[model samples]
Target: QVSSGDSSVVIDKKKDRRIRPSVVVAALRAAQQREPKFKHEAFIESLALAYDFVIASKSMRPGAAVKLLDVYNVLTIMPGSAREYTRPEFARDIYLLDQSGHVTTKKGRKMSLPASALTRSGGVLRTVTRNGQAKDYAGISFEEPGA
Candidate 1:
């Protein structure tokens, strides 16, 4: 299968037959579902196929960002009355930076990352919840795992 700008092709060399249009559509749909973040145009460009023999060409959706995890182990959720620290809005959005240097916006997703996920430099911005109230514990320490 090959796709170019506004064009695509599926070569069946064994039979030298063109793939059925419906099958092609199904395959593309499956591809998108399996990996929505894959760039459609880039896939076509990688194939380096000509459009003159393209059996099908349809507008494909751009890659979508998938939410995974958030950075910063703590967030300040206090309304107004701020000091100099991470903003409260940072608590609302889970900022996940993938290995590929791409960020995924995870709105409405709470940052429930494990303590091990954090580092001296980064992790999910966290605040301890006590008595149904959240409190910032900037200079506190918890027992290490198996320690």
Candidate 2:
């Protein structure tokens, strides 16, 4: 029998339970079916969509920020949406950017970007928090992606 945290199983004279390759493949297939396919465009679209909301918020309050969790919530709650931004792979995609760009997730009561970030014309994107918790506020001031 398999034991938790143990990679090797103790085989007895009467018990021989070996996992087959077919079993592994079947299990992987099932998991793949249950999860949404990772698409770069979909991930980018989600960010862009969240950026729109951030822009609106900034218009109301200068230097306002938004939470990444809020962006994930918005993407998942859309009607007829199939993209799953909650998946670790999808989430990791956001963290992939050029040297000049970065996404920050911090726990604090206040969130702000550096003044130098503002000079980019394309503002930096960051998630805001309050009381050391994420809030529904992602800050955006950067140029659109690919612009």
Candidate 3:
């Protein structure tokens, strides 16, 4: 298992090999199970590993745009587990990360932003209109729990 602080290794490994689909799914499931004790950090670490695995693996079906739902489906299929492992919030997190260009597929395609960047920058900004007035709206602020 990869340590939380060693995400760089995971990212680097993704660039070199084709990870197995089952390994990716297992990493995600492990992250979900460990979330309660380790909090979001566990999720982040697990996410990095899983993302790397998915991108490096060709078993995800060729030409199919990898989506968070696709990852979630794998999480939902774990055996002997009754807990809800998949959540829209988690999927959104993955989507935002992908949008940031930090993660990438095996084909050298970028995915999204790094979690650290999102936490430090207060997230992506957007334009919002209310009462015919347009204003800049800062995206959601993501902080690790208890931090």
Candidate 4:
């Protein structure tokens, strides 16, 4: 059993090179049962790690903002590797992170994405706004979270 705080992954055999999908699903289900509110906790943690990487490199400053697209890139695309965490999926996670972040779908977390001024060519996220345009939450703000 490999345990990290409340999350635990128990495999019967440690030497097995190829694990079964059912085992993974079972572990995940157990974790969810343990804590249902933090549904998107992995997404939030990954985003925070990526954001910290960008900040540490001085691509952005302390108490400053980083582009959401950039964070997605750093998280998904490594120097010599690639991943399939698509932008639309990232956008959805971001939307949920804002809506039900702090509590079990009740409060929000410390992270925030303030509005960004976009030009005609500025990046746009499909966060599903009622209006034609969504004021573009193009960047993420760590300042508000007291970075």
Which candidate has the top score in lDDT?
Answer: 4
Instruction: Residues 1-147, candidate 3: write the lDDT tens digits.
Output: 233453322321133132465765555455444423224334445554454445456464322334433344444557743144424345444443433444433334333332333334443333212232333222122222233
Tens digits of per-residue lDDT, candidate 2, 19-125, equal: 46576455545543453334544445456556557557546342344444445555667664524333333233443321114332221112232334233443234
Task: Name the regions of candidate 1 deviating beyond 4 angstroms.
Answer: 1-18, 36-101, 104-147
TM-score of each: 0.18, 0.34, 0.29, 0.55
Q: In model 4, what is the error at residue 63, expressed in angstroms?
A: 1.9
* C-alpha positional error of residue 27 in candidate 3 after TM-score superposition, expressed in Å: 34
Each candidate's clash count = 11, 12, 10, 2
Candidate 2 RMSD to the correct structure: 14.1
CA lDDT of each candidate? 0.29, 0.39, 0.38, 0.58
Report the C-alpha lDDT of model 4 over 29-129, residue by residue, as the tens digit: 55434422435667676777787788887766665667777777788775543334456556756776776654221123356675546323466666543
Query: Could you say which candidate leads in TM-score?
Result: 4
What TM-score would you give candidate 2 relative to the actual structure? 0.34
The CA lDDT at 8 in model 4 is 49
